[model samples]
Each structure stands twice: as structure tokens, then as C-alpha cells.
Target: MVDTLQLILPGFLLPYLDRFMQFGQELFGGAWQDILTVVWTVIKVMLIIAPLLLGVAYTTFAERKVIGWMQVRIGPNRVGPWGLIQPLADGLKLLLKEVTIPSGADKFVFLIAPVFAFTPAVLAWAVIPFSDFLVLANVNASLLFIMAVTSISVYGIILAGWSSNSKYAFLGSMRSAAQMISYEVAMGLSLVVVLMISNSLNVVDIVQAQGQGRFADMGLNFLSWNWLPLLPMFVVYLVSIFAECGRAPFDLPEGESEIVGYHVEYAGMSFAVFQLAEYSAMILGTALISLLFLGGWSSPFGFLPDSAFWLFFKMFALLVVFFWARATFPRYRYDQVMRLGWKVFIPVCLVWLLIVGCWMMSPWNIWK
Candidate 1:
């Protein structure tokens, strides 16, 4: 169906497609005459994301199931197909529920916050580089673009917490803002090592760079992934991402146990928006890790074809790690979380950046 549409569609549906196909065919051996080929390509991407979105939806269900299994109890089995429809039912319920605006809240900003939060979460996927030649927007500074867009998402949480005019929500917002800013710094620094090694901010470049040289030549196999070379930075970045996403152990922003947290006053669809943003951000975090550390969409062994399979595999591994961290670790205290960010993770990332710098300059040339 997608192929048929692309073949018959007007030349100017998306001008960029024509240019990209021309560039690909001329430079990369892709077909040139049917530049609209990207239409079908885009359809494939959407097909991938459709399942991913559904997976993200049911991830909540799986989290409950797993947590339930850990606690020796049944989870959501009441909905259709052993609660397979629970996420859908949950969506319907949120849609049907009433959206109430607090009397004392700033109605406009309160409503706008979720939109701000949700937009960037989805938009970041535009440059994720799911596979070789398979991304929505293949920008030069894709990493920088992602970081900038994600940073903007913090404003949404801040607005949501502040506009609601609730003390707890305000506190949650403050925590969220501080957490995101601090972690973002560490996350950016960690990527410096990746950029330094790859010599490019384009994700595809980073992955391709890792493929050069043999094990004896580089002293390791494909396991010589950036994760091994920059292990400390990888750990710091992972921890920072948890804080950035406001996930468990670092979920102080929305610490339901202690405070109602941000979005405390949001109800129904408004609340659902916040949930969607959080899940989307989680998927984005995993995708970034896959791109940077796990060699984004590249096979682990180097012999397998570079395809979406590697992308999904790496992403799934990260997602499992996320759940494991959530299940195994206890939440950090507010002050402890702040201290860890400032005193620990940030400093480590900075030090590693310096180490990478020194390594780059030395005659050793570990990266080379």
C-alpha cells in the first residue's frame, strides 16, 4: 500500500524526500528515479513505532505483572485476553474521565504544560537513527539537536507544577527542574567521549566509526563497543538518564510516597498526557543509549547485517535494565539525589571528559 502511494504521489509532497533520494542514489547506491521511496520507508518506520508504542503502553502492564510476580500475586488479568486490553481500557477510562481545573490554578498554563512535556518526547524520535539510512531527520548535529529538544521538556513539568497552584506540585516541579538540569550536564559530558571517539555528532557516523579495525588491531572484538572503552561514562550517563526521566530511585520529582509531586492536580486526559510523556522519554533514553554505547542498530558480533533488529534488541536490553533498576533499588532521598548529581555523577563525567581529552592527545591514541 505504501509503495503504491509513493509511486503515484505528486513530486512535491515532501520536497526533502526528493533531495534525500537523489543524494542517496548518487552517493549511496540507492534508487534515484523513485525518490518518493521514502514514503514506503516512512511507512515501515511507522509500523515499527506502532508496535513500539503498543509495547510502551503494555510495558506498564508488564511492569505490574513483573512486580506482581516478584511479590507473589496476580496482576491485571480482568481486562480482555488476560488483561492484554488493560492499557487500551486505561486509555479509554482516561478519555472518559473529567478534566478539572483547580479554582486557584492558572488555567492556561496548566493546560499547556502537558502539551509542552509531550511534544519534545515525541519529537526527539525524529532523529533517532533507528537503522542505517532509516531515520526521519538525518541532521548533522543529531545528538545536539536531541539534547536541546529534550531540555525543553523540563519547562513543561515546571509549568505543570507551578500553574496548578498546589504546594506539593510546586515542590515536585522544582525538584524536576533541578534534577533534569543537573543530569543533562552529565549526559552531555558523557556524549563528549562518544563524539570525540566518533569525531561526529551524527549517530550513523558514531556507529560506523565503531566498525573499523579488527580485534587484534583494536585489541577487542565488536564487544569493543563504546560501552567498554567509556564504561564509567556509560554508568554515569545511565544513572543521569534515570534522573532526567524522573524514574524510580531518582523519581523524587513525582515521589508519590512522600509528596503528590508534579501533575498532582492533573486529572483524566491531562494526567494521561503526563504518563505518555514519561513512557516516551523512557523509550528515548533507551534509544540514545543504544545509539551511543551499544553501537546503535549495529550487530553485536559485527558479522550480522546492520538492521532494525539490532536497534530493537539493544533498546529491549536497556528497557530490561530500566525495570531491573526500578525493581531492585530503593528511592533516593531528595538531598541525597541532589548530592549524587552534583558531588558524584557530574564530577565523574567531567573527570572522564578530561581523561578522554588526554587520551586523544597522547601518542597512545586509544580511540584510534
Candidate 2:
């Protein structure tokens, strides 16, 4: 969205800013432009982060309402019009609450652990393309950056578990760590196949690459997207995202019926922060799935103009599936989860990666 203030503000503001820039340069004899650039960069980042925070908040509302409908029950309808403002109310409650540290707990790490988890969810957005020009950091190695940054969140889980000074919390963290690591291997391999086909780490280039081929030429662009050609890897990535985000069936880390999660000792907003991190990561996972497989911001049909609406719509569709799966499936046994990740997903991804690589090298190559 364009900044409304740019149009509303006085016409003389630009010249005034220029005069202030010159005055600062004369006084400090240094890079006033760089300082302005930094300030502007911070503003752009805030634009990204502010919406993301709202998205994360509403995701919980969506999940609850979706699951409630599936289970034949009314969800949070008392807070606002059809419970639209429920997330906002919840945020207010969390903010007004207190942070509690358990006795004998490592206070510093206990406090900092949520930051480790939360920062990564926010960091991944830096490279996520909402539209052609609507990204904070459109770097060359954006895909690599996503993989690397997302991997760090598990450490936060482990630290939260350990620093809480509770055995159950530690056990939960261990489960989360192992689960995330195992799934990362399969997910990474699947993305590698995409990299082979697209031949670029830049997220924009990957999406643009999907906007071609016979189907896109025919104006059935959805058919041209990677989800069709990379069906198996697409499945792998989807299932891996569920496990990675610790959603149901794969949510062994926090078997709420049996064991508390890594943040068991946390209370009030401190606990809410961990939850914020989790749902933020869930949003990130959905965004990644939409981008890597569903063609990012591309329109479903060719005649429609590509926009952020398509990307957000696709993300919402995938998120409904995330909630549907959570409602439909039961939690897996921890051992079963491990077996699937290692014995099934890993080998499958590896084999599929090999097959895709070989196919690309064959005379039948269509991606070229």
C-alpha cells in the first residue's frame, strides 16, 4: 500500500527534508543520507513487522474458529463482531499480565529463549515476497537465508526447556529439537530439488520461473506452478512443515493431554510470547509452502493481474489445511514421529531429489 501521508503532508516537506539533510551534513560532516536511509529502512521493516504481528494474532483466531466449526461448536463470538476482535483482546490480556520465573530457573535464558524463537519467525519475513516490490530484503540467497534462520528456532525450544529447570520441559524440548532437525533434512532435500529446477536461490526468480511453460501460456497458470511438476516434493514439504511447526499429529513436543511443553514454567505474557513465536512460525511455514510450491504471488488464472492478494489468499488456503489436519488427526507417538521423519521422509526426499536431478539432465527436460 502507498503511504497516505505522502499525499496528505505539506508539499514543501521534501525541500525541508533536503535542507535538514544539508544542515546535518554541515554540522557533523558525515553521511546524513545514510542516516536517513537507515531511518527509512527501519520504517519499511516496521511495515512488514506490524502486519505480520497482526497476521500471527489472527491466525490463532482462525484456527480456533475453523476447528470449532469442524467440531460442531461455537468459538469465540463474545469478544467482538463474530469474534473478529478476539485476537486483539487476547493481546491486550497478555500485555497486561505478568511474567513469572520459576525458582531455581535460569532467569536470563528463560527470558531470552522466547526471543530466539520469535526473532526467527520475524526474520524469515525479510525475504518473503508479498508482491513484485513488496519485500524488505530481496537478497540473492533468500532461500538459503530462510533455511539457515529457521533452523535456529529449535535452539530456543531447547533453551526454554533446559532453562526452565523442569525435567518435563527439558524432555519436551528434546522432542521438539529432534523433530525439527529430522524434518529439516527432508524439507531441505525437497527444496534442493526446487533449486535444481529453478537454478536460483532468489525467491522472486523462483516465482517468476513458475510463470511460464505451456500451461501458463494457455492462461491456466496454476497448472504451470511447481506443485504439479514437483508433486512428491510438494507433499514432502507440506508434511515436513506440519512437523516443523509442531502442529497436531506431529505435535509430540507438547502433548497437551499428557505433558506440558518446553514453556511449562512460563506464565502470562512470557508464555504468550512463546505462543506468538509458534503461531508466527506457523504463518511462516504456510507462506513458504505457498511460495515454494504454489507460485508465490502469481494469479491462478493468467488474465488476472498478479498481486499480494493472491499470495495471502494462497497462504490462507494452506493455513486452513493446517487447521483441518490438526482437527482431523490424532497425535502420533513420539517413536512413530521419529520413524516417519527418518525412515520415511528422509529416504523419500533423497530418492526423489535424485530422480528429479536425473530427469532435468535427460533430453525430456521441460523446465529449460
On lDDT, the leading prediction is: 2
**Which lDDT tens digits does candidate 1 get at residues 1-368?**
33455687787774665665567678756454455466556775686578767877987887777777767788889999888999999999999999999989999999999999988877788788877787777999988999999999999999999999998899888888888898888888888878998899898888777766555244443576788879999898888888888889887755677766788899999999888888888988998888888777767664557788888888887887887778788889988988988889888888888988998899977667
- Relative to the unseen true structure, what is the C-alpha lDDT of residue 199 in candidate 2, on a scale of 0 to 100? 91
Q: What is the number of residue pairs that collide in model 1?
A: 0
TM-score of 2: 0.93
Which 10-residue span in candidate 2 carries the lowest summed lDDT? 1-10
Cα lDDT tens digits for candidate 2, 1-368 = 12444566688786775577678889767676577678778988998899889999999999999999999998899998999999989988988988889889999999999899899989988889888788888999999999999999998999999999999899889888898999999999999999989999999999989998999999999999999989989999999999988888787756777866787788888888888988999999999998989999999999999998999999999999999998999888888989988999888888888888889999988799
Total backbone collisions for each predicted model: 0, 0
Q: After superposition, how far is residue 179 of candidate 1 from its true place, in Å?
A: 0.9
- What's the distance in Å from true for residue 341, model 2? 0.7
For candidate 2, the clash count comes to 0
Candidate 1 achieves a global lDDT of 0.82
The candidate scoring highest on TM-score is: 2
User: What pairs collide in candidate 2?
Assistant: none
